[model samples]
Target: MRNLAEKPYVREEQREVQTVRRQIRKTFTRAEKGLLTLIGAAIVFSAILMVSNYASMYTQNQEISQLQNDISQQQQYNEGLEHQVSELSDPERILNIAEENGMELNEDNVRVLQP
Candidate 1:
């Protein structure tokens, strides 16, 4: 029919007009292009900063963990040395050693020194 042919032609013309409108909308002005470029750069810079901060934090945490382990090992070693010192300085052990060396305990000859 004649109307059916005209309908197809009208739809084609409408489609062409919409395509031209979309192309015009897609075109950006100089100022808009500059603003978009600045926004993209800012996003990239922020991402870089975030990654750098995370790396720094991770490194610091690892250092702290290693230091804690070192401190724990040092404390354990110090405690062991302190126990040995206490055992060596026992009064009974000192008396036995003095007897073995033929030294007698003389309270009157002992002098107390104060710091």
Candidate 2:
């Protein structure tokens, strides 16, 4: 490696001097100024885009929370339905419904016919 003192300075300090010596002024024409304005607008637009992206994420998170709540309610509903089905599956309840529907239980030795 070269010594630190041997390293040449890549950055020039007197940018004004270089411009003056080269007779190149940093003057902006109307179109150039408008282009710079457009670049600034693009930067602001990107910031708005970042904020809107986060906002949409927040909205989706809220939706997911609501869906989770709905799922919990559905689980409770399913549990209630399971309890009702269990209650209705008792032998007495089955015989009651069958009698109401005009059906009879078949004995092992009985032969049944349908029309």
Q: Give the best candidate by TM-score.
A: 1
**Structure candidate 1, residue pairs in collision:** none
- Candidate 1 on 1-115: residue-level lDDT in tens? 4675454543344444343444445689999999999999999999999999999999999999999999999999999999999999998999999999999999999888888
Candidate 1 Cα deviation (angstroms), residue 53: 0.6
TM-score for predicted model 2 compared with the true structure: 0.54
TM for every model, in the order presented, reads: 0.75, 0.54
Error of 2 at 52 (Å): 1.8
Which portions of model 1 miss their true places by more than 4 Å? 1-23, 113-115
Q: What lDDT score goes with residue 95 in model 1?
A: 93
Give the local distance difference test score of model 1.
0.92
